[model samples]
Target: MQNTRIILIGAGIGGLTAGLALQRRGFKVSVYEQAAQLGEVGAGLTLSPNATHALEAIGLGPDLAKLASRPARQAVLHYRTGDVLVDQERGDLPKKQYGADYYQIHRADLHDMLARAVQANDPTAIHLGHTFLGLTQNSDTVDVVFKNGARVTGDVVIGCDGIKSEVRAQLWGRVPPRFTGNIAWRGLVPMYRLPPGFKIEPASAAAVGHKHSMARYLIRNGTMLNYVAFAEKSGWETESWSVRSEVSELLEEFDDWHPSFKTFLAATPKDLCFKWAIHDRDPLPQWTKGRVSLLGDAAHPMLPFLGMGAATGIEDAVVLARAFQQAKSVAEALLRYENARRERTTFIQMASRAAQERLQGGKADGYTKKEHKNEEFLGLFSYNPATVAV
Candidate 1:
């Protein structure tokens, strides 16, 4: 961890968070993002207590409060009648139980905050428009080649690109992410656009119907209402995130739901409606091959039922950095990091799959007990990435 040059392949939340954590530990860090301009393409993200603890450890605690929404409670409701199924307080419970606060924030807001922090540490740390083509390594350094015919060398290379990662394809084979026949519609509506008496709770909430689910929450300090609706559909050929759909299509999907939720969807503009298919890959047997390793979606892409996709990636960043601090060499550090993370991430992935099945009206075996009702989230929420052994 002493002044070794580290190259991160993607500038996403995982990549940027790893850069800052490595920089703070006295490592020279450089982040390369494929995009010409950095941005996020989602409505909102749920930062549970585990992720909040990791961010605070990386010194983003105060800045997070200023940019995120701390929902007082979270609830699950019946899709037709609006009856509460599960309601749990979040304000002080997370702090008392997990030693951190749960947060909901616009994805872009969190991305920008991390980019600024990385810049504030070193202005030239992040490089834009640098697409990773391939890499070659000897005994000491890895030489990374970009699409523009430029090469850069570093002591270690970390791949945070995403599910369709070039690094993963180059190191392993071209394994495609499997689509689970689930399509989701997402949009954000301003608070002022809602009609009178259409009350949205000041908490992260989800309503479940037959083979469909709708989640609504606030972001940017309750000024924006972020909504995501999911249903089973077939024949979605496109895999890109920029796929646009009609607002009427969205309305038809949720027409039988509660009226309050329907009113909220009616306000969404046609141009603002976005849809994407849910895709994930099975957990890899290994994340590190020599000096290179995968992180975030590249390592373990899971369904969003538990909402820990980004949070688990954040955990990878912290634990990987800590492994570097405790180990004697870079390879040893990476091995230690993988040993610490693989089981936890794989469990979450499988649990997320089961939760998705249940939500889609599969078997209802383990969802009855109070403690096991939301048990998949407890292991994720209670983890502390900084102090966990590596």
Candidate 2:
């Protein structure tokens, strides 16, 4: 493995996780990111047992626990009435049942932790501002050219560059992702901002209504409430996270909901909000082309309704590392990685789409069943990438 030099494109969760895992496996890894700096701004993510196990395998469990909040339970609520539709215990129950706990953490905190781990393994491994331009490879090695006119070479290139991946576009040509007709407004509010009489339970609560939904959960050790409200629309022309949204617009979208839900939105300290239209691609029949392969959103992007998007990416990193551990050659390892991961990711992709439909069609109960079913959640949560055969 020491002779293997791996190049990872993207500095997000998937890329950083893969860098750490590959470094631990004794491979030389260099992570290149298009961003000027490594940071996750104004977003949140849920890490189920499967992701927790993967992070623990890479020795970041203790750090993650400190940076994240564990919800006592996850409940689906009536969007207009705030009534509980379904409840699934989390916290110790998930840890007891699946050997790892479910956690919600600010995206920045998790990304920072992963960056720290990668730096500890190799201080100079991360390169910022290296936008991927294109790549060319021979039978034995690959050369990647960046936008800055810098070129880097490696044994294999892993595309964790995300949904609009340059590597995917360069490899498979530009095929645009289809918009799911849903736009989401995301905001973070300090817990102290809530009115004194307001009593919000410590749980991951999803308020579901006709063609709209809002999920509120705690992050940053319960000091901040991460809110994501979704509404169905004809289309959103811009698919970006930097788009500013007015608070009034957000309020108008959910005006008919429960007063308590509205209260949560009103409690926001400022008018700042970020919104993005959800877009996903049909699963590609293949995730690999020659020595280059894709991971995370680059490989498969899905709706956020199921909260498995990042978790699946984390799973990809671990399984990819496992594939390398067992296979004799780079090509063999990548093939094994895809063979082991494609089915699971595809299943989650379809399930999340189904869940999105159920949520918008006034049948969130169906999505809840999909979430609560032992076979569905367990089959996903209980997967141990460290030991799973690749």
Candidate 3:
């Protein structure tokens, strides 16, 4: 495996995890990112046991726990009118259960941790500001072309660039992102400073106003409350991150809500609120093309409802690196990766879509929050790349 030289695009969780896992598997890996700076603007993510197992396999479990919260207890949901819809328990993870704890973390904190691990484990790794534009590969080697007029050679290339992946373009002619007719509004507020006399739920770091199709969570030791509000809409010209949105306009969407929810909206600063039109893609016929393939959102872009987008990508990275270690050729590794992951990730993508629809007041057969339990994710959670066989 040490003879393998892998080129990974995008320095997100998936890419970094792939680097750590491959390096641990005796494969040489280098990560590239288009961002000039490592700053990521996003709220916390719930890393269910499946993702936790992948992170632990990469050797960052202990440190990640320190940087994240495990939630004192399970979450309770309401329909914004103060009617309880679901009350579930948390914390029954076994040693070999999912192979890790269901850790929750701020996106930036998690990325920084992975970046630090990538650099520390291998000093001369992770090239920032190197944009991936194109690539070409012969039978024995691949040449990755970048926007900076530089070229890097490797044995295999993994695209973790994201939903609007350049690698996907390089593989299947230009496939644009499809707007899923949903508009998302998100903001973070200080918990201690939320409006005075606000009667908020106690188990709430965040809460969901089901009537408005919104959800919330907390980060930074429960000091900051992460708020996510959504509604059905259509046709976004561009699906890029960080779209501009006015707070006044966003607040209008929830103006007539419950007093507590309105109070929560009132406390959000104008500048902190940003909005984007949500999107996702249909599963591709194949994730790999020759020596180049996709990972993370590049492979499967799911709604954030289940919060498994990044987690699934992390799992893909670990499994891919392990598959390469076990297979005799890069082609075999590529095939093995798709074989081991396609169905599972496709299920998640479908589940995420189902969850989004259900939350939007749409009903469908065989789709229930009961089936999308924290335990169901344990299938992907319990997978450990070090000892994984296929």
Best by lDDT: 2
Candidate 2 per-residue lDDT, tens place, 54-79, comes to 99998888998788889998887888
- Provide the RMSD of all predictions against the true structure, rounded to 1 decimal: 1.9, 1.9, 3.1
Worst 10 residues of 3 by lDDT: 362-371
Which window of ten consecutive residues has the lowest lDDT sum in model 1? Answer: 362-371
RMSD of 3: 3.1
Which residue pairs come into collision in candidate 1?
none
TM-score of 1: 0.96
Please identify model 2 stretches exceeding 4 Å from their true place: 364-378
Candidate 3 lDDT over 1-390, as tens digits, reads 558889999988788888888887778788889989776677767787777778888888888778876654444344345444454444454343556666667888988888888788787888889999889989988999899998999999999999989998899878888888888888877776676665444433323443346666566777777777877766554565577677777778776555566676678777777788888898887888899889999999988777789888988989998899889999899899888888878988887887664555522223235633433443545655445555
**TM-score, each model?**
0.96, 0.96, 0.90
* lDDT for position 364 in model 1: 24
Misplaced by over 4 Å in model 1 are: 362-372, 375-378
* Ranking of models by lDDT: 2, 1, 3
Error of model 1, residue 336, in angstroms: 1.1
